[model samples]
Target: MRDLIKDAIADLKKGDGFIYVTADGSKIDLHDAASKGIAVTPVNPKNQVIKKLEAAGLHLNDGKFLNELNELISLVTGNGVTSKTSKRRTFSDAEKSKIVEEWKKVEAAGKKTKAAFAREIGVGYQTFINWLRG
Candidate 1:
């Protein structure tokens, strides 16, 4: 990852604007290395500098832009980024089975009325209908 970050820095120093593709197929504007605070005057690649980052396992993907610049800088400068953590719950096997079973019943009913399906599953009709479409 460090190698990727260093390569990005080198590219940025060379006056290249990083191109990032958003999940929705939109492009992101990442202008320059100087703007991102990664020094690149004269824009030359340093082998020793790259080696240090590579050894530390810091890497970024091509065209990801400076959204991760602070993180990379923290890795290189020994002061990593800090943030709060949160826990998330995944659906249990029983829950998954229930949803599938509900879907089956909804299909088997033949008429497939929104109200009927919602009543069968004990959820709001609108919510059940939206879930079906989603």
Candidate 2:
């Protein structure tokens, strides 16, 4: 049983899917194993399907096995881990000083709060505060 489970995991790692046959002869398809939906089953501690998969290191939540499966899928599909990359804006020292000076003027005039000023200048409130601190 352990060997079977290990072999299944190995196959998944090699970008191949398998169908697990339960002791009762029911079939559980592990196609697209990287997907959470593919691993859904009733939370029964004695469910052979779930038990075997869990024993093989597959967890419903994010876990090492799932990560491996995802990596394999990414390699096979040519869609590596999808991450959102934001373009960071860098301000020069002169630009920073100028913005700070303008903020000071606004502060003296009591026209707008720092958060509003930050919004007006297209920066986050926390980022603006950090700039001011610097």
Candidate 3:
């Protein structure tokens, strides 16, 4: 019954002409002279067809109904997630100063003919001198 009324409404709109429907045992023409659409007023207020059409029209006009329909669509047709991990580390300023001080000692020793100190620290002599200046 609902689908029939839905189709009838669509057809009436497409045809854009008078559609005769029995309203409470009386024949009446809906949208008698409309150019773009049809409008039918059923006489029996409690008729099932009239109730269904009214309900459908009300649901179509409601903002909350549209929001709920959108939510249902998103639930049924959503995409999956992807990874979002970072790959970097942070160090404190104190830690950096300690490392620089250790390098400066080896560099100062390497300059005073203890070239083996720089080699033992696994740093080039020039690199050690650069570290000592900081």
Candidate 4:
């Protein structure tokens, strides 16, 4: 892991972005070393630097470097990186028909489109349109 960090620093110095590989062989772009505050100026890759980078790449491929980096980032930023997830909503056929009927009533009463009625009823315009399509 230390070797990987060192290589990452060297890579950053050379204006090259570090590519982190996971145990599953997925590649993630970690940007440059400067962005991670590991190094600043570009440096020529010497024998020592090359060896360090190769070690780092191995650690990255094994998934150790990424976990450590994530932990470090969470410690510094106060929040760990995470993906967002949302629950899917399901509507019944009867509910869809009722909503379409209500939309028609709103349209009869001077509402320009079903979008306004959808907003009043708390459904998204696209969702309402999809319901209408059925």
Name the best candidate (by TM-score): 2
TM-score of each: 0.24, 0.35, 0.28, 0.32
Model 2 lDDT per residue over 1-134, tens place:
66766755554454323345444555455453334354433222324445666766665333345546666787789985544442467889899889999899889999898887876665678988988999
The parts of candidate 1 lying over 4 Å away from their true place are 1-97, 109-112
lDDT of 2 at 10: 58
Instruction: Report residue 74 deviation for candidate 3 (angstroms).
Output: 2.6
Question: What is the TM-score (0 to 1) of candidate 3?
Answer: 0.28
Q: In order, what lDDT does every prediction score?
A: 0.51, 0.63, 0.49, 0.58
Model 3 lowest lDDT segment of ten: 79-88
RMSD of each: 19.0, 19.5, 32.2, 20.6
Name the lDDT of candidate 4. 0.58
Best-to-worst lDDT order: 2, 4, 1, 3
Ranking by TM-score: 2, 4, 3, 1
> Residue 52 CA error for candidate 3 (Å)?
2.2
- State the lDDT at 15 in candidate 1: 42
Q: After superposition, how far is residue 77 of candidate 1 from its true place, in Å?
A: 64
Candidate 4: list runs displaced more than 4 Å: 1-88
Better of 3 and 4 by lDDT: 4
Off by over 4 Å in 3: 1-12, 25-58, 79-134
